[model samples]
Target: GAGVSQSPRYKVAKRGQDVALRCDPISGHVSLFWYQQALGQGPEFLTYFQNEAQLDKSGLPSDRFFAERPEGSVSTLKIQRTQQEDSAVYLCASSKTTGPGYTFGSGTRLTVV
Candidate 1:
Protein backbone atom coordinates (compact mmCIF):
# COMPACT_ATOMS: atom_id res chain seq x y z
CA GLY A 1 0.00 0.00 0.00
CA ALA A 2 1.10 3.58 -0.58
CA GLY A 3 0.12 4.52 2.92
CA VAL A 4 -1.22 3.11 6.15
CA SER A 5 -4.65 1.55 5.70
CA GLN A 6 -7.20 0.94 8.40
CA SER A 7 -10.36 -1.13 8.24
CA PRO A 8 -13.90 -0.50 9.50
CA ARG A 9 -13.67 3.27 9.28
CA TYR A 10 -16.63 3.38 11.63
CA LYS A 11 -17.74 0.81 14.16
CA VAL A 12 -20.70 0.67 16.48
CA ALA A 13 -20.14 -1.91 19.16
CA LYS A 14 -22.65 -2.95 21.77
CA ARG A 15 -21.31 -3.01 25.28
CA GLY A 16 -19.21 -6.07 26.07
CA GLN A 17 -18.77 -7.05 22.46
CA ASP A 18 -15.31 -7.64 21.15
CA VAL A 19 -13.88 -5.58 18.33
CA ALA A 20 -10.85 -6.08 16.19
CA LEU A 21 -9.34 -3.22 14.22
CA ARG A 22 -6.88 -3.82 11.45
CA CYS A 23 -4.02 -1.70 10.22
CA ASP A 24 -1.95 -2.28 7.15
CA PRO A 25 1.18 -0.19 7.21
CA ILE A 26 3.20 0.82 4.23
CA SER A 27 5.43 -1.93 2.96
CA GLY A 28 8.92 -1.96 4.45
CA HIS A 29 8.13 0.32 7.36
CA VAL A 30 9.65 -1.17 10.45
CA SER A 31 7.91 0.82 13.17
CA LEU A 32 4.17 0.53 13.71
CA PHE A 33 2.20 2.23 16.45
CA TRP A 34 -1.33 2.28 17.79
CA TYR A 35 -2.95 5.25 19.44
CA GLN A 36 -6.29 5.99 21.01
CA GLN A 37 -7.88 9.38 20.54
CA ALA A 38 -10.91 10.34 22.55
CA LEU A 39 -13.21 13.14 21.59
CA GLY A 40 -11.41 16.48 21.88
CA GLN A 41 -8.12 15.00 23.01
CA GLY A 42 -4.82 14.27 21.41
CA PRO A 43 -3.85 10.79 20.37
CA GLU A 44 -2.68 8.69 23.26
CA PHE A 45 -0.05 6.10 22.57
CA LEU A 46 -1.22 2.55 23.08
CA THR A 47 1.52 0.35 21.73
CA TYR A 48 4.45 0.10 19.37
CA PHE A 49 5.90 -2.76 17.37
CA GLN A 50 9.11 -3.03 15.46
CA ASN A 51 9.20 -5.90 13.05
CA GLU A 52 6.87 -8.31 14.86
CA ALA A 53 8.42 -7.53 18.20
CA GLN A 54 6.28 -5.54 20.61
CA LEU A 55 8.78 -2.99 21.84
CA ASP A 56 6.49 -0.95 24.02
CA LYS A 57 2.97 -1.51 25.33
CA SER A 58 3.02 0.27 28.65
CA GLY A 59 0.71 2.93 27.30
CA LEU A 60 -2.12 0.48 26.73
CA PRO A 61 -4.90 1.28 29.17
CA SER A 62 -5.63 -2.24 30.29
CA ASP A 63 -5.23 -5.92 29.69
CA ARG A 64 -8.28 -5.95 27.45
CA PHE A 65 -6.34 -4.02 24.84
CA PHE A 66 -4.04 -6.17 22.75
CA ALA A 67 -2.05 -5.37 19.60
CA GLU A 68 0.09 -7.56 17.44
CA ARG A 69 2.10 -7.22 14.28
CA PRO A 70 2.61 -10.85 13.37
CA GLU A 71 4.78 -10.20 10.34
CA GLY A 72 5.80 -6.62 11.04
CA SER A 73 3.56 -5.22 8.34
CA VAL A 74 -0.09 -5.93 9.06
CA SER A 75 -1.24 -5.24 12.58
CA THR A 76 -4.37 -5.72 14.60
CA LEU A 77 -5.64 -4.05 17.74
CA LYS A 78 -8.27 -5.99 19.59
CA ILE A 79 -10.43 -4.86 22.44
CA GLN A 80 -11.87 -7.81 24.32
CA ARG A 81 -14.89 -6.17 25.98
CA THR A 82 -16.04 -2.86 24.69
CA GLN A 83 -17.25 -0.25 27.11
CA GLN A 84 -18.60 3.27 27.01
CA GLU A 85 -15.21 4.64 27.94
CA ASP A 86 -13.75 2.77 25.01
CA SER A 87 -15.55 4.87 22.46
CA ALA A 88 -12.90 6.67 20.49
CA VAL A 89 -10.86 6.74 17.33
CA TYR A 90 -8.09 4.23 17.04
CA LEU A 91 -5.17 5.46 14.96
CA CYS A 92 -2.36 3.56 13.35
CA ALA A 93 0.88 5.05 12.17
CA SER A 94 4.02 3.68 10.66
CA SER A 95 7.49 4.97 10.01
CA LYS A 96 10.76 3.73 8.66
CA THR A 97 12.37 4.31 12.00
CA THR A 98 11.67 5.58 15.49
CA GLY A 99 10.75 9.18 16.31
CA PRO A 100 9.51 10.99 13.20
CA GLY A 101 8.45 10.72 9.58
CA TYR A 102 5.33 8.94 10.69
CA THR A 103 2.45 8.42 8.33
CA PHE A 104 -0.85 7.97 10.10
CA GLY A 105 -3.95 6.19 8.96
CA SER A 106 -7.36 7.82 8.99
CA GLY A 107 -8.28 5.61 11.90
CA THR A 108 -11.26 3.52 13.00
CA ARG A 109 -13.92 5.35 14.92
CA LEU A 110 -15.52 3.11 17.53
CA THR A 111 -18.66 3.88 19.46
CA VAL A 112 -19.57 1.59 22.31
CA VAL A 113 -23.16 1.73 23.28
Candidate 2:
Protein backbone atom coordinates (compact mmCIF):
# COMPACT_ATOMS: atom_id res chain seq x y z
CA GLY A 1 0.00 0.00 0.00
CA ALA A 2 1.14 3.52 -0.68
CA GLY A 3 0.09 4.62 2.77
CA VAL A 4 -0.68 3.09 6.13
CA SER A 5 -3.84 1.00 6.06
CA GLN A 6 -5.96 0.16 9.06
CA SER A 7 -8.79 -2.33 9.05
CA PRO A 8 -12.37 -2.12 10.32
CA ARG A 9 -12.65 1.64 10.11
CA TYR A 10 -15.07 1.41 12.99
CA LYS A 11 -15.80 -1.22 15.60
CA VAL A 12 -18.44 -1.61 18.27
CA ALA A 13 -17.56 -3.96 21.07
CA LYS A 14 -19.71 -4.97 24.00
CA ARG A 15 -18.34 -4.40 27.44
CA GLY A 16 -16.00 -7.24 28.39
CA GLN A 17 -15.57 -8.20 24.77
CA ASP A 18 -12.31 -8.16 22.90
CA VAL A 19 -11.31 -6.42 19.69
CA ALA A 20 -8.32 -6.49 17.43
CA LEU A 21 -7.35 -3.62 15.16
CA ARG A 22 -4.98 -4.23 12.27
CA CYS A 23 -2.52 -1.97 10.63
CA ASP A 24 -0.50 -2.54 7.46
CA PRO A 25 2.20 0.00 7.13
CA ILE A 26 4.17 1.07 4.09
CA SER A 27 6.67 -1.40 2.77
CA GLY A 28 10.04 -1.44 4.53
CA HIS A 29 8.99 0.84 7.34
CA VAL A 30 10.97 -0.31 10.37
CA SER A 31 9.28 1.69 13.06
CA LEU A 32 5.63 1.27 13.93
CA PHE A 33 3.68 3.00 16.67
CA TRP A 34 0.21 2.72 18.15
CA TYR A 35 -1.65 5.50 19.85
CA GLN A 36 -5.01 6.11 21.48
CA GLN A 37 -7.04 9.22 20.82
CA ALA A 38 -9.92 10.32 23.02
CA LEU A 39 -12.93 12.21 21.70
CA GLY A 40 -11.34 15.61 21.45
CA GLN A 41 -7.76 15.23 22.49
CA GLY A 42 -4.58 14.45 20.63
CA PRO A 43 -3.42 10.89 20.23
CA GLU A 44 -1.43 9.42 23.12
CA PHE A 45 1.29 6.90 22.46
CA LEU A 46 0.50 3.34 23.48
CA THR A 47 3.36 1.26 22.17
CA TYR A 48 6.15 1.15 19.60
CA PHE A 49 7.97 -1.61 17.79
CA GLN A 50 11.27 -1.56 16.00
CA ASN A 51 11.19 -4.36 13.49
CA GLU A 52 9.80 -7.39 15.37
CA ALA A 53 11.07 -6.28 18.75
CA GLN A 54 8.71 -4.28 20.91
CA LEU A 55 10.88 -1.46 22.15
CA ASP A 56 8.42 0.44 24.30
CA LYS A 57 5.03 -0.35 25.73
CA SER A 58 5.15 1.97 28.69
CA GLY A 59 2.34 4.17 27.38
CA LEU A 60 -0.19 1.41 27.23
CA PRO A 61 -2.83 2.14 29.84
CA SER A 62 -3.17 -1.38 31.19
CA ASP A 63 -2.25 -4.99 30.78
CA ARG A 64 -5.32 -5.52 28.62
CA PHE A 65 -3.80 -3.46 25.86
CA PHE A 66 -1.34 -5.35 23.72
CA ALA A 67 0.38 -4.53 20.44
CA GLU A 68 2.63 -6.53 18.19
CA ARG A 69 4.46 -6.43 14.88
CA PRO A 70 5.37 -10.00 14.22
CA GLU A 71 7.07 -9.53 10.84
CA GLY A 72 8.11 -5.92 11.19
CA SER A 73 5.51 -4.67 8.72
CA VAL A 74 1.93 -5.36 9.68
CA SER A 75 0.89 -4.69 13.25
CA THR A 76 -2.09 -5.42 15.44
CA LEU A 77 -3.41 -3.73 18.51
CA LYS A 78 -5.61 -5.91 20.65
CA ILE A 79 -7.75 -4.86 23.54
CA GLN A 80 -8.95 -7.43 26.01
CA ARG A 81 -12.06 -7.07 28.15
CA THR A 82 -13.14 -3.88 26.56
CA GLN A 83 -14.49 -1.08 28.73
CA GLN A 84 -16.47 2.07 28.02
CA GLU A 85 -13.42 4.11 28.82
CA ASP A 86 -11.62 2.29 26.02
CA SER A 87 -13.81 3.88 23.39
CA ALA A 88 -11.54 5.95 21.23
CA VAL A 89 -9.70 6.06 17.94
CA TYR A 90 -6.71 3.80 17.77
CA LEU A 91 -4.10 5.23 15.44
CA CYS A 92 -1.25 3.44 13.76
CA ALA A 93 1.81 5.13 12.37
CA SER A 94 4.98 4.08 10.64
CA SER A 95 8.29 5.58 9.62
CA LYS A 96 11.43 4.42 8.00
CA THR A 97 13.41 5.22 11.11
CA THR A 98 13.44 7.31 14.27
CA GLY A 99 14.88 10.37 12.56
CA PRO A 100 11.99 11.01 10.18
CA GLY A 101 8.33 11.92 10.50
CA TYR A 102 5.78 9.14 10.38
CA THR A 103 2.93 8.33 8.08
CA PHE A 104 -0.30 7.76 9.97
CA GLY A 105 -3.24 5.56 9.25
CA SER A 106 -6.89 6.56 9.14
CA GLY A 107 -7.39 4.81 12.47
CA THR A 108 -9.95 2.39 13.87
CA ARG A 109 -12.61 3.89 16.04
CA LEU A 110 -13.72 1.53 18.78
CA THR A 111 -16.85 2.07 20.82
CA VAL A 112 -17.56 -0.07 23.82
CA VAL A 113 -21.07 -0.30 25.11
Candidate 1: residue 29 Cα off by (Å): 0.3
The 10-residue segment with the lowest total lDDT in model 1 = 92-101
Collision pairs in model 1: none
lDDT of each: 0.95, 0.94
**Residue-wise lDDT of candidate 2 within 1-113, one digit each (tens)?**
89999999999999999999999999999999999999999999999999999999999999999888888889999999999999999999999988549999999999999
Instruction: Give candidate 1 regions above 4 Å deviation.
Output: none
Best by lDDT: 1
Could you tell me every candidate's TM-score relative to the true structure? 0.98, 0.97
**How does model 2 score by TM-score?**
0.97
Clashes of each: 0, 0
Scored against the true structure, residue 50 in model 2 reaches a CA lDDT of 93
